[model samples]
Structure formats: C-alpha cells, structure tokens
Target: MSENWRLDPDRALPADAEIRKQARAIYDEIASLPLVSMHGHVDVDLFAANKPFRNPADLLIVPDHYLVRMLVSQGYTPAELGVPFTDNGGTVAGAEASDVETDSRVIWRRFCENWRLFRGTPTRYWLEHEFAEVFGLSAPPSAENADDLYDELTAALARPEFRPLALLDSMNVEILATTDSALAELDSHAELARTLGPDRIVPTFRPDSLLHVRHQSWAKEIAQLAEVSGIATDDYAGYIRALEQRRRAFVAAGARATDHGHVSADTTPLARTEAERIYTAALRGEATAAEADAFSAHMLFEMARMSTDDGLVMQLHPGVLRNHNARIHEKYGADKGFDIPTRVEFTRSLQPMLEEFGLSHDFRCIVFTTDETVYSRELAPLAGAYPSLRLGAPWWFLDSPEQMRRFRESAIETAGFYNTSGFVDDTRAFASIPARHDLARRIDAGYLGKLVAEGRLGPDEACETAIDLTYNLPRHAYARHERNA
Candidate 1:
C-alpha cells in the first residue's frame, strides 16, 4: 500500500492559487446537492430485495467492464479476474475452466497487487473515492492489506446501514433511472416503486436488440416482446404496434425516455413497402446485412416519431462497435469491454429525422457519441440550430477529466450551456455513481472558475451556471418523466 495515500480536497480544481480558490467556493455550493442520476445500468432488483452484496469482488470487480478491460489488457485473463463464464460450454482461448479463480479473497489480492496499473486514470479516482468516502477505509489497497480490507468491507456490507436503499439515501440521490429492455417485465421496478416510492428508480426503454434485425437472436427477442406486449409481431406493422405498446407500459411504470445504441447515427426512413419487405425477410431469417442496416435506420426514425407522440425523451448513443473482440465475447458474453469507437457522421445521417421533428415542441433527442471529432464540427452546430436536439455529455470512453474539458471547450462555443444535457453517470457499478458525479461537478467548477478568472463571465453568472450544470439542466432534460412520476 502507498503510505502517502490521500485524496486532495482540491483535486481536479484549477492549479493556479486564485483560480483554485474560486473553484473551491463553487464546488462547495453544489457538493451536497441531491444527485439526479438521469441515466445508468444499475439493477433495480438489488433495491427490490435489499440484499447485501455477495462479496467484494462481485460488488467491485466483476460487473465493472472498465476495470475488467484494464486488467485483461495487462495480460490477466478474464477467468483470473473472477469473471463468470457462460454456462453454455464457452471457453477462453488457451485456458480451461479449471484455471478460473473462484475465491473472492484471491481475486481481491490480485486486484490490489496490480493497483498501480490504475494510476492517472478515472478508474483510480473513482476507486479512491469509493475506498475513502464510501467504505471509510483508512489505507489504500495494497497486497499486504487486501485481506484486511476485504474483511472490513464484508463486515460493513452486512450492516443494515449499508443496504441498497439505505446507501442510496446516504448518498443523497433524488432520482435514479435504470436501463431496461423492451421485453423486460419490470417486476423489479414495480417492487421498487412500492418499496422506495414512485420515481425513485425510473426505468428507461432500451430497444437496441429489437432494432438490430441482423442479430442472431432477433427473432427470439421479437417473440419475447410480442409475449410481453400481448401484440402479434409477425409483420412489420405488428412489430411497430408491439413496440408502441411496450413504450406505454414503460411510461405507466415511470419511464421518461427511450435509449438507442446504434452503430451509426443513420436515421433515414425507408419507404413503407421496403420496410415491410425487409421485416418479412428478417422474419424468414434471410435479411441481407444492407437490408438490416436500412431497417435499423428507419426504426430510429420511427422511434423518434413515437417519442414525439408519447412525450418520452429520446437518447441516442451511436458509433460504438460492440463486441469487437470475438474471442472474449464468445467466451464470456457481451459487455466484456471489447466495444470500440468508430468515426461517426451525424449531419447527413440525421437529416431525415431532424427535418421531421427538429422543430417539434414535444420532441426531444439527446445525442451521445464516443467520437469526439463530431462535438464541434457537427453536434454543436446541429444542436444550436434544432429546438429539439441537445448534445449529451461526454460518455463511455470519453468520460475522463481531460476529455470532459476538451468536450466543453469544443462544443460550448456553438451550442452554449442550455443546449447540452447535464452530466449522467452511465455506470453499472452502483457504488461508483457518486464518485463519477463528484468528478464531473469538480471539473465543471474548475471550468467555470477559469471563465470567471478570464473575465469572460461574471462570478455570479458562473455560480448560477455551475448550479444549472449540476442540477437544473438534468431535471429539465428529464422533466417529462419526473412530472409523470
């Protein structure tokens, strides 16, 4: 363990003395404000059961793709990191099931031994915050203290104060939105509604599987959606109707938005007959790749139309090439952190959808991309012009401090502050939520302080802008769901 371990109160603030002083004052104003988690992947069932985490490894290392990917990149296999293997006879390359580590203590030690690998990364910052603020650990993780820390966490997690709902209250989270599939029953969400009350844990509709007709399991998922919605989906029109019904169910269950994870931002609508033909081919398991892409693009347009009618905000996260590592995917399943970003173009791709609903008062779309090149050249200009479009915060691979600064510098000139959605921690690791949000708030304070120091913005204006970026903007962007809840 590093004996010098300590988190500086002014970390990530401006380095200059005067600017750091200004930034610290701004940070203090919003540091304790209720967190509005507008987007995340935390499982609602954890709250439904209010169960203690199984172990330190299960809680920290297993589900976090960010950590798992880093460990794997450094020559550690997924099996060594305690990642569960698929039950359907999947095996890692050049490794056998017998080699997999099953003891939580062993995995924890391995992680501590390699703790230095996380230096200078956001993962290190988040882990430090979680270790000190969340878990109240006095020392940093090291090979010598791994077992002791693991035991401490295990005991702490067993207490009622550390239960899911109790921890949420302690964290001062006002709202948390979870991503759910279109075919999901949402029974856990319903349980959370009764346990935690309405809007505490809202669900967001995710239809990525349904949109990609070329996926091997598309037909199976369609059948599941039909069963859940009680609407036949054998034809194109029926599929649309089924999706609409699911959206209604989501709204009734306190959903405020629909999330799309597309490979590109293509939203060109196909002619009705062509859409039907593609749907028919997909149903027959014969749709070509080109046809599937066309169908997915058209479905994006249809989703926007549905959002306009239902009043659910639409969030588009495009440009990720998911499952880029076939070997890992075939061995461990999706979300192994093999997804990579590709160059994306939004101007021409979104023209059809934007032309249709860009001026609609009821329609709202928040676009996110890992490709930072589009922030200034395309996204900022598009958001500046469209009443319904807003740029999403830096996400996925770009959710680091340096990238966040670059994002603000590039996009804020054109889109201004209001045309951007506030920070949303798109995290699956529940404990990391506060840490991630804290990082964003500190970064925003530093950025705003610089503006005030440079005389570009008044101190009062900077403070108000900081508040909006931290609180008001997220509430406004997700207002419909908050109102419905």
Candidate 2:
C-alpha cells in the first residue's frame, strides 16, 4: 500500500478476488520474459557515449512525450517540462525553466509533488513499474522521498552496469532493432557490433526523411543522400538510384527493413515519363504543392518496387496529420505529440500499389495506421487478400492496454492472428521498452483468458496463442521479410 495504488492486476482485469489472482499469474509469467524490441528510436548516441544519466527527471520525465503531454494536459507547458525549443530550423535549444535551481533533485521534487496528477493514467503504471522494479524503489515517489529516490537512481546510474549498453544486457534483450535513416552512416551500430558482437543492436532503415515532401530541408536532404551513397542526384532517375544506393548501404550496415511514413496511404505507380517530369520539377524546386504530393504517392510505389527487388521488409506507417499544432511546431519541432490522427481510406489510396505488387509472394510489407476505423474497413481485409501485406501492430497513439485489446478484437476476426505482425514497442524511449512490452503481453494474456473462459478457445490453444503473441510470431514476421541482417 505504501508503493502505489493497486490497479487491476495485469493492467485492466476486473478486480475480483479470483480474476485478479488469475491475471497476476499471467502477468508475472509474461513480465519476466526477455524483451524483443524490433522497432524503437532510442538514441544510439547514448549507448555510444555510455555515460551515466544526468539525473532522475532528465531520465524519466524530460524526453518522454507521454509524460510531457500528460503534464501539458494539466497546464504544464512543454517549455515548463524542460522541452527544448526550435525556431523554424527544426533545431531545439534553450531550457524552459529559467534561473531556478536546475539540479536533478529539484526537478524530481517537482514531479514528486505533482505525482497525484498521474494517478489513474497508464503513465503512472509505467512509471511505478520502472521505479519499483528497475531501480529498486519500494516507496512511492512523493516530495518526501523525491531526493532519496533521485540519489539512489543517480548512484545506480554511475555504476558500470547502469550504462546504456550494460543496461540492455541486464534486461536480456535478445534482439533490438533501432530505427535509423536510410542515409545514415550507421558507424555507431557498426562500432557497437565490433565491440559487443553482432545482432545485438541492429539498424532499421527509416526513409521518411527522404520521402517527406513537406520537409523544409528536402532538397538539401536529397543532396546529402547522394553524397553519402555516391550516387548522382541531378534528376528523378538519379534520386531513385541514390535511394537504392543508400538502401544497400543500410543493408550492409545490418538493416533488413525499410520504413516509410506518409501523410496518407495514397500510392501511385505512374509511367516512367511522368515520374521523371515530377522529379524534374522537384529538382528545380518548381513543383506546386499538389505535384509534390502526387510525387510522394508515386515514390511510395517506387519504394515498393525497390523492396521487391532488394527483399527488404517494407513497413508503411501512414495517415498521421503531423504537427497539428502550428504554434508547437514553431516552438518544439516535430514528434512532440503534436501529431493528430486523420481520416484515411486505404482501399482506394493503396489500390495502385496493391494491384501491382500486393499478390507477390516474394514481397513483404507491414502496414500501420492511426486510423482504427480502417482496421475492419480496409487494413484487415487488405491483409487477408494480399500475400505481400501484413498488418502492423497498433501504433503511436494506440499503444495501450485498451487499444491493444481493441486491436485484437477488431483485427483478429478478419485478418486472423497469423496475418498480422506481432507487437513492436515502436517507442523512442529506451527505458519504456520492457514496460510497454509487459503491458502488451499482459493485455494479450488477459484477452486470451477471456476467450478460454468463454469456450472460444481451449486453455491449451490459448496458451499457444499467448506464447506466439509474446515471442515466436515476431521472429517469424521478421524472418518472413528476410530480416536476417
């Protein structure tokens, strides 16, 4: 009782004496399993530096959008949460709190005083889990104990075992696929492999920086890609060649998949001549906004073609209306929880690509969307039909117990469990990896428990599904997509 409020055991099971016990058994089993993180944006630089964390607040609260957004909802601005600032150049600078005591203990005290704000949120559960299980903090975080907790965590962080590399090892992460740019050199990953042996910290090629037509640095970015890949970038043909070259570089750097994020699922496989024309316009920086969008659509199809040839698993996470808050974009740059969901229609938007490559057995694609309405309406049906297509786990805004359960309920009936890729944390925060996966596994086990109780599945079958969802399925999904790299 001194630790934290007991939420329903395993996250959201009803708090009946018998049900709670059943859920606890399931949670304990899953929680103790090794972490499998196939998607995340944790800074590789942190591992490379291998430095002790600066402080508790910096480690726990500052970098997490989940924490910042929750506080923001309660009248804490991003600036107040120490979110760095950006001034239209997409560069962040300046601290939010001015001249106040900037020590780690002070910041931790701020969080502790307001700990009640997180009372019923998933954020509370995650924070408590990390504080209690990882850092060995038995007492709940409050102003009275804030400094003590901070001192303990800070001391722990100074130890050799608390370094990022050592922490990953301690957590027993079998495989960690880190998100990276297609144009990235991946020297860090290479160095890490050389130092620690292979297949530990693998790179994932995220080409969204190349595909975002709205990027202010789009032309400069293309040039950088060309320079990195040693490919000419004078025209559309040159652009494609440069992208392919970079893709090869990423593959050599231990990437087996290519990730794309578009504003919508709209895809077009246009005639080569039209593509060249669009490329010419973009090269000259003379294309209208509409043409740029159509060009992006065309590029999606081209990317699929490249994936087909190269055998890299293609992951498409489209349909996010990014940076909905113009003021925030003006202040904090992108990926600060300013992105909002938009209506998406994949059936019509993806028909061109599906018509061309969806049935191909050699190609593999995982499609993710924020638009849950399309689970039954488009994604599951499409996945059910297309050999190349597999549904990605619920992502970004929907990575919660309720959302995971809802996803299983909606998608399992149409696409079946086999047609979908198992869960990926898809988080940027490194420490949240185990907590996120724990939540997913617990929710999955609880869901299976209901099915077993309802007679839809025997307990034996439910156990198999639980294990698959927890472990084997993700391995198969990645292996199917030729993710051996």
Candidate 3:
C-alpha cells in the first residue's frame, strides 16, 4: 500500500464485513446527492464578492471555532492562530500578551504540525475530507509537510475554480440558507441572488440580538432595527412591529426559515402587560437578568406566533452556555469557541408554546440541541405528538459519527424518521459544508444498512429512506418548495 494518506471508499461505513458491504451499497446510492444546507453561518459576502480565499489558515483554521477550540485546549491561543483582534487590539480582560501571529504561513504551520492532536475527532475527519477530496492532497499534514502543503494550498486558492462562488457549485449545494441578523440589510444576499437566481442563496432570519434585552448591544440593535424597518421603536408595541417588519423583509429576500438560539428552551408566555413592563424596564436599563430571561422566553412564544402567520419554518437551537470563558469572550468577541453545552429540560420549557401552536397546520418548528439526554426522553416524545414539531439533526457537539448513530437510535423509535428534520450543517466554515454533509449521510447509510441486514427493513425501503434523509426531508422541513414562491 502507498504511504500517502488516502480516504477509504467505505471510510464511515459499518465495520462488520457483511454489514460493511451493505452500508457501502447504501452510501453509494446517495453519496452524490445535491446538498440542502438549510441552516449555516457562512458569511453571505463570500458569495457576493466571489473573492479568492485569503489563505489556507483563514479559510480553514481561523473561522472555525471547532478547530480553534481544540488547538486552544492544547495550549495554543487564538491570537497565535491568526485570529484577529476584535476588542481594542486584544487589550481586553484576560488577554494574552503574546504577539498575535499575523503571518498566515506561521499559523498554518502551527496547525499542520500539530495534526496528530485532532485524532478521533470530527474536526480531523472533516479536515481529512477537505484536504483529500476537496484539495486533492496526497498526504496528511504533519510538521514535515507543513511548508509544502501551505504553498500548495496557497497556489490552489489562487485558481479561479477555487473561489467561493465556484466552490459552491463544485460542492453541488442545491440551496444554502445563511443565518443573518434581523436588522441586516441583506445587501450581500441581494447581490448574490441577482447572479445565482433567487432561493439559491437565501437568508435565514436570526433575531437573537433583539431578544436578549440586557445585552450591551440590545438598545443599539433595537435602534438599528427601527432604522432598517422604518418603524420607530420608542415603545414595546413599536419594538414588536419593527421585528415583524424585519421578518417580512427577510421573507421577501427569499428566507424560508428563522433560527432562534437560546440558553434554555423556555417558551413560557407572559401577559402583555408583564411583557410591556419588562420591555420598558429593559429600555430604561433597569431590567434584571431574570427579567431579561423571561422576556427572551416570552419572545420565543411571540416568534412562534409570528411564524404561524408568515409561514417561515422556525428552527430553535437551545441549551448553550455562551461565553463560558469571560476573558476570551471579552478579548476575542463572541464565537471564539468557548461555548459549553448544558443539560436542557424541554418538556416543561416548551409546554406553553406546544399547547398554543403544536397542532397548527400553518406552524412548523424544527428543534435542535446539543443535549442528547432530551433526544429520547423529552424532544422525541414532544415531536411525536406535536404535528408542528420536528427533531433537528444532532448538531454542534453531538454531530460526530458515534453521536449521529446514537441520535438515530434514540429518537427514531419514538418520533420515527418523518418527524425529524433532515441534516442541517450548522457551520460557519465554508469548506466543511460538504464534508459535514457527507459524514452525516454515511452514518445514516450505515444505520440503514444495519436495519436491512437485520431484516427489519427491506433493501428497497432502506434505499428510499437513504434518499429521503439525504435530500427530500430537508426540503420539506425547511419549506424549500415555498422558498421561490
């Protein structure tokens, strides 16, 4: 065998010989399906500009919190990895004083030389796929190959075919949904749509900044929302109206879904007077943390109500303890990969919203969490009973091969396959999109293969399930058909 690192054709398939063969067959049938990435954080400006990637480090390492977090755990700092200074030249609290590495080559070298540290991680898997399949690398990165590989990647990125827009086609993405602020003008989305056609590069309305009332950016975001929507937000009613107007703007911009990320899944509704009181207090900078949380939960209910009226598929990803490391957060800004997962109780937390709109035909919500404990206990049962609820794919910390299989095993028996939203690669890394999707599909195929081999499912039925999991289910869950209309 050659010494060069190469991906096995059946890399993620079943390990048992007979089961492996069946899995390979299943994977083969669905491997080339066009990707439907319904929820992602890729910057829309990439497609709008169609610019050559800045460098290998910027494209692969700097933007990916997954990559950043692991390297940080091993004692490397974000600044050392070429992460830019966002807060006053990295002079914030707990900021490391080491010179921020500005050379992309040095940052890339640090990453490539330390490749062994990524073993048994999904980051490693995605990087391997990106290097081998996407970039056509013949060997895995190591200290010896660091400089050569950096030069190779730099050259490859300079090619016209390697630009972001062209790479989207190369990845065979049928449609992409970008997570955007509720207050955004979506100028980049408008420009990309003009060239790529509508619904191909669509916006996903994300209004997290508006609901976290006590955040430093809240008052500013509200003002920006007022300016963008042309609706004054001097009062609670005006604030609601401005948010509604923003949602409408997103729908007009070809959004089929709206994404909500909260620390808890609480959807408890408050009395209008109570909500008004909270909003007024928040505006006056007098609201307590508990009050802010109550308002956030209440607005989730409000958002669901709005979704019912406008038909934007609602996506809730809850239970993240954002900014666990206050020091890194202060210096690096948000999404520098210090977020931690917490145990989430969805049954009581979601009861109020479910009681109101769970059976409605017009409302559809796909709930996601990194909390695996709720998959079988709370989320699956809730989704099984509520027509409007669907279990989102295992995401963030739980989207690995083992965890994906665990998710299928845990949720499918109760909620069944149809009640689940198909895989959505919730990522900011542009190159990892296809790699993540492929891993999910392969894991699914392996799961289906086991069922067929056990005689629980026929081969034809398994194939159909594979195809649905790969393409069809995502379209239905994300309201893709309605995207253009």
How do the candidates rank by TM-score, highest first?
A: 3, 1, 2
Per-residue lDDT tens digits for candidate 1, residues 1-485, read 44344689998887899888888888998899899999899988888888888898988998888998899999998889998776545455656777778899999999999999999999998999998888887688888899988988899888888888898998889999999989889999998898778789999999999999998789999999899999999998999999999999999898988999999899999999999999999999999999999999999999999998888999999999999988778778888788999999999999999999999987999999999999999999999999999999997889999999999999999999999999999999999999999999999998888888888998889889999999999999988743344
User: Number of clashes in every candidate structure?
Assistant: 0, 0, 0
Between candidates 1 and 2, the one scoring higher on lDDT is 1
Error of 1 at 11 (Å): 0.7
Q: All candidates' lDDT scores?
A: 0.90, 0.77, 0.91
CA-RMSD of model 2 = 2.9
Q: Which stretches of candidate 1 lie over 4 Å from their true place?
A: 1-6, 89-98, 481-485
Better of 1 and 2 by TM-score: 1
Worst 10 residues of 1 by lDDT: 86-95
TM-score, cand. 1: 0.97
Write model 3 residue lDDT over 1-485, tens digit each, in one string: 13365798888888998788788889989999999999999999888988899999999999999998999999998999988767655465655445678899999989988899999999998999999889877688989889888888899999999999889999999999999989889999888888889979999999998999988899998889899999999899999999999988898889999999899899999999999999999889999999999999999999999988888999999999999998787778898889999988899999999999999988899999999988999999999999999999999999899999999999999999999999999999999999999999999999999998999999899999999999999998987434336
The total of clashing pairs for model 1 equals 0
- Model 3's number of clashes is 0
Model 1 pairs whose backbones collide: none
